[model samples]
Target: MPDSASDVFDIPADVLQRETARIFRGHGLLPNDADWVAEALVEADLRGIHSHGVTRVPIYTERLARGLFNPRPNVCVVRQGPSVVSVDGDNGMGAVVGRRAVAAAVDVVAETGCAAVGVRNSNHFGIAALYAEQLVAHGFIALVCSNAPPTMAPHGGRSALFGTNPLAFGVPAPGERQILADMATSIVARGKIILAQQRGEEIPLGWALDPDGRPTKDAATALNGVVLPFGGAKGSAIALLVDILAAVMTGAGFGTDLPDFYNDLDRPGNLGHFLLAIDPARFGERDRFLERLGRYINMIGDCPPAEGFERVQLPGEVEAGLRRKHLSSGVPLSQDILLGLRQAAGHADVSLEL
Candidate 1:
């Protein structure tokens, strides 16, 4: 659900962060873990990806309270080889598991020049870009993949059999931001449709199909149906690849075996994620690599704009721009979403005025 200025309320990032952490802490998460999770969600909000931001607080806290997700778990990292490791999240919060996994990857990458970390038994980790950005900040190229609960159908099939599996990649770029690409394989993330449904808004055609396999704009119907994959077969194929690496290889649930994060309260999500990090200096001089990468980025940026479009922008450029602007102004939240957040805060006995 896209937000318009007329229907939004601005909350300063720092204030939102404090309140969100309080809510999580009130719900039983350890103070440090709650703070980290709050920062992660707020970072997404600052970047304008509200679907994965604070809007998720209600469902997340609900699941936590219901004991569907672990508020605290002993995340274990097992080193399989010189550069390979495995993580067992013990049914922990996905972002918490992801934070630990990425930290292990960073250490491995520092030791071996590259790392491959497989994670299992985790819940929904919001925004893969968070880990990618962290790796990029360490001057390492990163590829992050996560297998979610199934929401999309296999190519040519009408049943929901595939996750809107997401993939993210990031590398250090000249100046401020990294060259980052993060996306769900579906035509749109299921969260957007969920948001639309929550707001009683209609979705766009081609985003999903009704149960009868007919295209529909009704968000509720779409949720009952299946989301379409982007680029049809191509996206479906990529989704399968992500599932293989993130779920199958990591010993997590796949296909229908994966429980829905929103509807399945009886079991843990048992989701999986894979992270790969490569130090650029592993192959050549770090300065030379940076210089060449800068030149390539400049070439892309200087490309002529196509009709109805501005000059070429790197992947994540728009989100980065929004982040900078929102840091000073504030993150925008729809009225409905704000109300929901407040209600969630109340449930945890945490007062939230924003």
Candidate 2:
């Protein structure tokens, strides 16, 4: 363990994945589904997004055991066109549903030079970047969006009326580096607030509002309240666009109609996601595209920093740096998260060494 007060103990990435898989399998998920789900969660943790990491394992396990989620959903491609496809998640794990959609999109793009896919009846798919990165690895530009449970309010509306609605974009670079941008439309993701609450910490004033719509530092109250949009109206507009494209376009539940990921375990959460893959070679020379991208990145990196700042990083640079550091050092597993995983393992009849 690191001596720093803010630092956390790092566990090997494979250990975390095994533990996660064990817990999920205990809850009745098939071995393959459990492996994919665990991989996605562990990958998120490795990328430094602790909010969506193993901390969520217990909740997922409990939901699955309680019959809130279908452990063996028959996820299938429901419709197919030359450039477009649609999938029915059949209430299966979100990671499985998301991977299937990305695979479908990649196959279509390979043949037609471009493809778009919409998925419905899925659960939370962890990080959107995971799917986008798949396309990036295949020499394609990827765009992904998903509609989440309502956590944000529409502009001028005091009640929660919209989802955080994350969007991800990824473009392959010349070398191993890829330009990836993944973020929620809200001022802060709901996962961060949940983490703060679990740690008994308070959040910044602007991250969320109180139940009465007043800014508050309390995480629990903010969980009940509404999260603020990223750029006020601009972010609200983006959230609306994501909801329409992911949910409405896919004929999934929209707005307040979506089920809660945790609390409501009786019904299937009709969540939706959209993925697009564009083959750069279709429009321009691959090398030329990469050269221009490299130039743009260099220009951004060369920008003069303000006082106390050292560099201007692209969207995924910080995450990539953190991932590199954590991969070698280990991933941090908080006591609370560990306890949850242990409890989930016990419930699933799996013995966890941690």
Candidate 3:
């Protein structure tokens, strides 16, 4: 462990994944389930998405231990049609439920060329890109979205009533150059503020408002308050759409109906997710679609960068570059996060040096 919480540790990705898996297993997750969740979390760290990465381990394990989320879930399929499926996550961790839903979609798309999956009774699923990329790898265009516990107010409201709903999209292009876009409707995810609070750091001025509805830069104040939407009303509208599709349509909690994941340890997080997969082969020739998408990708890549920017890059290009660099250099994690991971590991009698 580092001498100070501010110190940074660059641990190997595989090592972190293995240790995290062990920690989760110690918390009662089955071996395969533990591995899957650990891999997704570490992959997010590899891509520089720390807010959705292993920093979440402490809360996740705590929730599991407290029975706030089911460590072992049945993940039953409630309904299915030719191309649409509805899943009941059985109050499991969202990462596990989301993967199971994606697997069902992949199986269906293999025969139907398209599949829409709605998942309810789930917990937080980390990041939507985790599932979107899975479909993209299977030669499908993917759109994935999820509704979280309300942390943002509606467009003009003051009290928290809308979630920082997130959406992710992915399309296979050429080689390892596929397009993957993931973002929250909020100015920033609440997890970022939570992380800032954990690190004793201040947030940017515009990220959130205090409980009094005044904009605040204090992380703790922001957590007690509400986060702002990304593009004002536009972002709010997108969030509404996500809630409708992911929560309302999926029979999950929405708006004030959902329990906050961090504060509401007494209740399960009844989150929801919507996953759609479309096979290019269904529209026409898969190769032809890829060729056209390749041309489109080239067109975007050729665009000149504006001032203050280095170059034009696709949606996931920056993160992909970061992943390539970090894979060998190791993943940079703050000692604060390391401390939390250490405590979590100790609970399971697992010793982690990093």
Candidate 4:
């Protein structure tokens, strides 16, 4: 349960997971599938990434009720080559579909030492890190990517043409959490804009441009505009690379063909995803690779910090730390989300027990 603070509650991780799983099941997902999706979103929240957390349950359930996606889809996998696989999600929930893809890739790598998996006709899969994390656990280095609806414009171009395509990587390690990096090519995720708009907050300039391609601070306006690409043209190029691999190769809808999940509730996203799993044993001794990987993480943390910062922080370190703290201290959630959860529970016929 959350505390008596100002419109805030600190829900425990297990409680949230149980309740969320129940809601998903009530919405037509099988028990196991519901649990998987619940874990994905709850993990995002535990890592302090509120943008991809349970706040999404409302919209997701609404879409579910509208029959935009298959609550129980038959995710089919086909071998493309000796070590390549392709998956058709049947318009399934991204979390469920992504897990199936990663699992298939891991299985292929188990037989071939390396694997590439392409996924198509899926909906918005949450964080890309989840798949990478899964592969790393199976002793494989992993790269994952997904294409989103249009949010970012090509460098020096005016309207949106490319998605805020995201990529993630996970390196294998023995005594460490492994090196994990997940990022959207855009300066920020559009979900952050939606969160800001809900909070009546202003967005930072330079993060996005208005519909006319001018910088804007209003979160709602910025959302209606184009999100900026990170590192200018370089990031735009990376985003294009992601789109080609995740969309073109996977045969999913690309660029603007994919409708926004929020704006067009009944339209299936038909998103694309890609995953690569490489065995460290193929390069050298697995033990040595793990040792070196752990060394690098320690060295990075040991570096002295610049002014205004206490120490160097790795890409996933902050979120990992937040996860550890929240697991014991309870997950802090806003009242608005709590209320929405209540509504979602009612719609799905799940008991929130608030």
Best-fitting candidate, measured by TM-score? 3
RMSD of each: 2.3, 2.0, 1.2, 1.7
lDDT of 4 by residue, 64-176 (tens): 99999799999999998999999999999999999999889988998999999999989878889988999988889899999998888999987988898989998876564
Ranking by TM-score: 3, 1, 4, 2
* Candidate 2 per-residue lDDT over residues 296-350, each given as its tens digit: 8888879999889898877788899888988899898866677778888888788
Q: Which stretches of candidate 4 lie over 4 Å from their true place?
A: 1-6
TM-score of candidate 1 against the unseen true structure: 0.96
TM-scores for every predicted model: 0.96, 0.96, 0.97, 0.96
Model 2 clashing residue pairs (backbone): none
lDDT score, residue 291, model 3?
89
Candidate 3 per-residue lDDT, tens place, 205-302, comes to: 98998888889999999999999999999999999999999999999999998988888889898899999999998899888898888888888878
lDDT of residue 182 for candidate 4: 84
- Look at candidate 1 and give me any clashing residue pairs: none
lDDT by residue for model 1 (270-301), tens: 99999999999999999999999989988897
Quantify all predictions' global Cα lDDT against the true fold.
0.91, 0.88, 0.91, 0.89
Q: Cα deviation in Å at residue 175, candidate 4?
A: 2.1
